[model samples]
Target: MKAMRDVWGQALVDQGAKDPRIVVLDGDLANSTKVDKFAKAHPERFFQMGIAEQNMVGVAAGLASIGQVPWTSTFAVFLTHRAADQIRMLVAQTGANVKLAGSYSGLLIGAVGKTHLDVQDIAIMRAMPDMTVLAPGDNTELLAMMEWANAYDGPVYLRLARDPVPDIFGADYTFEVGKVRVLREGAGVALVTTGTQLSRVVEAADLLATAGLNPTLVHVPSIKPLDADGLRAAVGGHDLVVTVEEHSVLGGLGGLVAETLTATGPAARIERIGLADTWGESADNAYMLNKHGLSPERIRDRVLTVANQVLASHVG
Candidate 1:
């Protein structure tokens, strides 16, 4: 089972208990998304928007207008694309206190096929004005993100991974919005990762450490309104930077980091380790991950290769 689903459900319940004004809106996927737990507790505040995701956003926006913090839950693809107009007009444009919970982001929604996988939600949401896009690296981060979103005053998009990901950040780790946390420090190569790929990066770091090579591991949970300064600091001492993520290399965290480096005048060698330019069909999660080069072994190999490149440059 997905640990993130349980963490999000618990967080929602906790938020609802603290604030009676908290409401949940589901698009006929309450049970699957784990928002049904909140609905069971607060039936009066929960709204079943049916399969109409567009109307779900509208309902969330209206609820937000009335001092209610509404959470809209659905698969990432449907939530971002189906409700694009309502999100842009009612949520982003008006700056509503609505939280869009996009479950099963990237190809993690495997077995559901190409139509369900949402590799482009981040790129789409980040383009919206006044929208805060957050992708938690694990269950711990997801819970912390929920706490942050509840206290925040604007529209937010919370992308969730469906896999049973590793618990990276400890229970006591504090999550600050728009801040990147460096898991390791290294002078050779930096591995920047976000979302589900963070666990793989952690494994890669361990693999490199065992080989007498240290690779900096940076976790970026927030995508939009990113902490460019923090990313720069993490990448400063590294001879090369390698970005790893579950999403596509285009318009994702890797692309954002590249854009940041370009503007900040860091001309260091950079590599993007993410899904290549391709669409996926229906498949299991493991098969989908390996097909896209997102497996832990692949990440370890990529990091080692990048380290070798740095060594060669120094030797020459």
Candidate 2:
């Protein structure tokens, strides 16, 4: 297991070696975001932008305009909330080749408190017309997605967690934009999620299976431009579709799933498990997850209850 941010830092270094146009900008958080690795390796290509996230984004946009690929690194909350306007106007509007790496996203950054946590980043980025929002499940997937982002000539937002997570994909894994990967195949229930929460969902699926509630597990790495056909097919015959994330249910993965299902045919009952229109508190990883009803045991219990309710409704 490896931290996604560490993988991102190494991937940036590797990409920098191969692509001369690649440059990195940090908002006074090189050490925390793990972009310090790139700064050390390629000091000439690295820019220390201090705590000015907005200025960093603008600088990145300018660099991109000059045929350079610029990656801006900072906490997710600062990048998505503080520099939102600059990202929308300069990067998204112009379709700049700027990559935004939002480290320490979601509610797991306990030491930093809610001020540093960002549960609405997906909503902010996905709502942008030209932005590509991605949240890899693990380090291997993050590396693959970084490669894909490098090749794509547009604005990209990569949401990364703070700590290490179990590897969900192998070294041979290849990332395709706007696609979903089905990890497990079952019936009646579909457990769909994105980001690091996928590891917990996989565990919950195992517990569900033991309880005779075998579910179909789908991992959605690309939030924007979601694979509608793949999602629909994966949960077609399922009675319940549970969309989970380390984000808000409002306009994150859950919102994307709801929008997709409503736009397409074959309607199913959807349950969104995530932050519920509330702020996160500073706590340890286990406490935060259990409090947010995101732990493996909590997720399993909730899914089982919901599955039973669905069955009862069908009987009625």
Candidate 3:
């Protein structure tokens, strides 16, 4: 399995070399964000903006104004919160073609503590107009999203995890924006997931299948500008719909799927499995995930419980 850093860095290098207008701006974390690969290949197209995320955003906005596709790199916490004002005023307000690559999103930055963790970024960015938020589940999806964002015209935010996740899509898989991938198909229940949480969903689906229940698995990579039609179709007539995410349940994939299903007028029960609205300190990603009931076992239990509830509701 390829790491997210490899996919992100390689995509930047590939796109930067192809398009002369594509430029990279690093907030002194190019090495972590994996933009160093691009810097090495095309020095003139890469700019080091030190540790000032605000200045880096403004610089990217300026470059965007001049018809350059500026991809900014930094930790998710700093990129979304520390430079929020600049992102709002410059990128969202102006509708510039700026790409924001926020690496180490969620509690994936182990041992960095709450100060570095970015759990609220989805809620913040989703509220901003003209911002397309994306969280790829694995390396193949990340590569496809990077290609899409480079050609996409407008403000875009790509959230990537540092640690390697299991590969879900095949090498020949193609990704479309605002479209979800269904790995497993079932009728009793459906699992809607985004980011690294998808790996757990896959495992949970297997367990559910072994228990004589087939659970549908949906992978929603794009958080903002959700694919409501596709979601409704995938979840149509299902007894229960469960949303899983590695981020907060309030405004992440869980909330988005819930809203869409409700609007679609589905009588199916909606369940969310994700991080609560709380901060996390320095700890292992796996431990943090398990603490918040994000593990495959937790997901399986929740889905089974919801499935039971759905049957009860129907029987009544």
Which is the leading candidate under TM-score?
Answer: 2
Clashes of 1: 0
Model 1 clash pairs are none
The residue-by-residue lDDT of candidate 2 on 191-294, one tens digit each, is: 99999999999999999989898899999999887879988888888899999899988988998898888786658999999999898888888999999899
Candidate 1 minimal-lDDT segment of 10 residues: 1-10
- Model 3: weakest 10-residue lDDT segment is 258-267
Question: Which ten-residue region of model 2 has the weakest summed lDDT?
Answer: 258-267
Candidate 2 or 1, higher TM-score: 2
Among these predictions, the greatest lDDT belongs to: 2
Give me the overall lDDT of model 3. 0.86
Candidate 1 is scored at a TM of: 0.95
Query: For model 1, what is the error of residue 235's alpha carbon versus the real structure, in angstroms, after optimal superposition?
Result: 0.7
Instruction: State residue 285's C-alpha deviation in candidate 1, in Å.
Output: 1.9
Candidate 3 per-residue lDDT, tens place, 1-316, comes to: 7778877888889888889999999989887878899999999999999989999999999999989999999999999999999999999989989999888898877677678998888888988998999988888888888888888889999998887789988889887888877888889798888887788789988988887788888888888777788888887878888888878888877778877877745457788887778877788877887788888887888788878888988899
